[model samples]
Target: MESTSPMRLSFEIRQMSPQQKLPSPDVGGMSRSARVMALLGLQYTRPFHRDALFLFFFALGPAVWLSMTVLFALQPSPRHALWSPVFLSVALWQPLCEELLFRGLIQGHLLESMPKQKTWLGLSISNLLTSCLFSLAHLANHSVSWSLLVFLPSLCFGFMRDRFGSVYPSILLHVFYNGGYFLLIGSATR
Candidate 1:
């Protein structure tokens, strides 16, 4: 019988062809920031069809907004004016910034460190934590009740990020949600 030294075994493994080597979870020695970027889905996934995505969300957006409109006894703000700077900012800018931070950075970091398979009610652990934080962030400007109300939509936004593996879908949904809410139910001061 022959005994192999650790150094000799290591050398032998290095000599193997790439195909012969087992895959590694080390991400090819990527830097921490690079790995995080990859986790943030900097690269779009294969089979990302733009038209399909838009069509589905276009249908989904109206249904969701309409449901909320019917469920809540909300009335339009007396000062409501279309295409105002405040409305544009709330509908467009806020969604872009919030999605990039919550889904892109925070959730991306959590996904990288936590067990991806762990979930509650079909939502990933990373997503749940991120959604909770997203809702909490609203407390700075909104009432406790309103902050709590924000949680469900935050979850939906986070779900889109997880589902698409990109922040764009979340931003898109968020824009729709905000735009609809402001147009249909939100106060002018928002």
Candidate 2:
């Protein structure tokens, strides 16, 4: 008796061949920065995205320091008086720019070039280098002590970016962390 199932008794096969060339996606329409950011967004995983976000807060650190210095210089009579608006600006703008540059651009590129296991090392080195650059960028502000404190958090942000594979959370954590510092120190200073 013959089976009536859809199984075939004989099969035909064809030779496999690889394509000589692969087509590249069209990106000519996108602006350089836009294209780069889009690539970063895609390449980074959820955790890294979070980390990028956290790193964003570090951007505010220098700004906060500068604003405070300016206010203090202008009116040493009431140190705490300028906290209101500065605090809000730090909470808002710092994270946005920091994430854009550090986690989104810098770490994103590092992760692309290095192997997964080495991501931590890459992130650490990159974070240190960039953080130093970041700190130095504020040379005009000229507070070694503040820069040192900022460095610590920047390292934490780098670790966060490596562990999570995203910058979003990093920016959030950054904003909160720096904001807390601002509130605490500003309140105490006042």
Candidate 3:
């Protein structure tokens, strides 16, 4: 069995073949910053149509925003504006870390480990599994109804990740989602 060393694993995109073109999780030999940048580069998947229209429509469209609007109406946050540490973190850091872990790591992991063609109702089993796990991960942070509400968006985020063949789009969507909700919450509260 032949295994490439860490030094050889983190080569530039142009150095790899089309099949191996997708960036692997190999941050080997790279500086900490470079490794982070690479991991967040959104180059770690197969070729995709990569249309902004789809990203907007499917993940960040009117329907999604409306759902968020409804949620805000039902459960407007107690917090005030974006100044609060918690609100700021939720609008920014939370999405980044969550998407990085869920879409970038977990969903990607399912894609790598699960059967490619195994799907239900036109959704990949991996996507479904990732969505379920994503929802469950938030169980402690929210009530059962809220976690169930979260599951729907989890599916959307996972689909965005899969459709774009990268996590960047989903991350952006997550940011927009939280930011919008919080913005509404702030305004509605004050």
Candidate 4:
């Protein structure tokens, strides 16, 4: 029988037996908005731990910045600061959409559908794929360097999603990353 109950979804990657597959999300009875959100990887039912979130902001953020800076020598040099409301869109709104779509929906779907195979140390093949796609998606606006550079942060976002069992922390990290980078640019250039 087909089930139509609106049920919760998990964004975390679970360790499963070799031949085992993940269960599909329960979206039958869900509201249209919820179903849409679920399809995009925004599972509201998952838990969000404080430790994970704090790590994303404080510990992981600076660590990532420093590492990327050393690896790519990235310097945020903004031409000028826009005091208008659009800054929020660049820093928060756009990042929210990106994290929801990339880490939340696309990566979340990969986690659900693909077999969880350890690619390296602890990175899953699905996560590696998602990060590749996420980085590739940035090819147009950013320079080739930046496009390739994005993979690192994208992977971090995926890690946050998996660690926290939800995309909320990833979303916040995205916001923190974008906002801080742009702010640095504005302050440095102006």
Structural similarity to truth (TM-score) of each candidate? 0.68, 0.52, 0.65, 0.67
Alpha-carbon RMSD, each predicted model: 12.7, 15.6, 10.3, 7.8
Q: Candidate order by lDDT, highest to lowest?
A: 1, 4, 3, 2
lDDT of each: 0.66, 0.52, 0.62, 0.63
For model 4, residues 98-170, the per-residue Cα lDDT tens digits are 8887777787777766645543434556668888888888886666777776787887777666544467777
lDDT (Cα, tens digit) per residue for candidate 3, span 1-190: 3232222333222233334222345667888876555444455444333554444544554455566555556445554545688777877899989998888777777766543334444355666888898888888767666677778778777766765557876777788787766665453422
Among these predictions, the greatest lDDT belongs to: 1
Clashes of each: 0, 28, 0, 1
- lDDT per residue (tens digit) for residues 168-187 in model 1: 66777788888887787765
Arrange candidates by TM-score, highest first: which order?
1, 4, 3, 2
How much does candidate 4 score in TM-score? Answer: 0.67
For model 2, residues 1-190, the per-residue Cα lDDT tens digits are: 3222221222333221222111111357988875675534323434333233344554555555555554333222245544566666665577667766776677666555533222222234455666676666546564665565566567666555544555655676677765655554453333
Between candidates 1 and 2, the one scoring higher on TM-score is 1
How displaced is residue 72 in candidate 2, in Å?
12
- The residue ranges of model 1 lying beyond 4 angstroms of the native Cα positions read 1-36, 46-80
lDDT score, candidate 2, position 37: 55
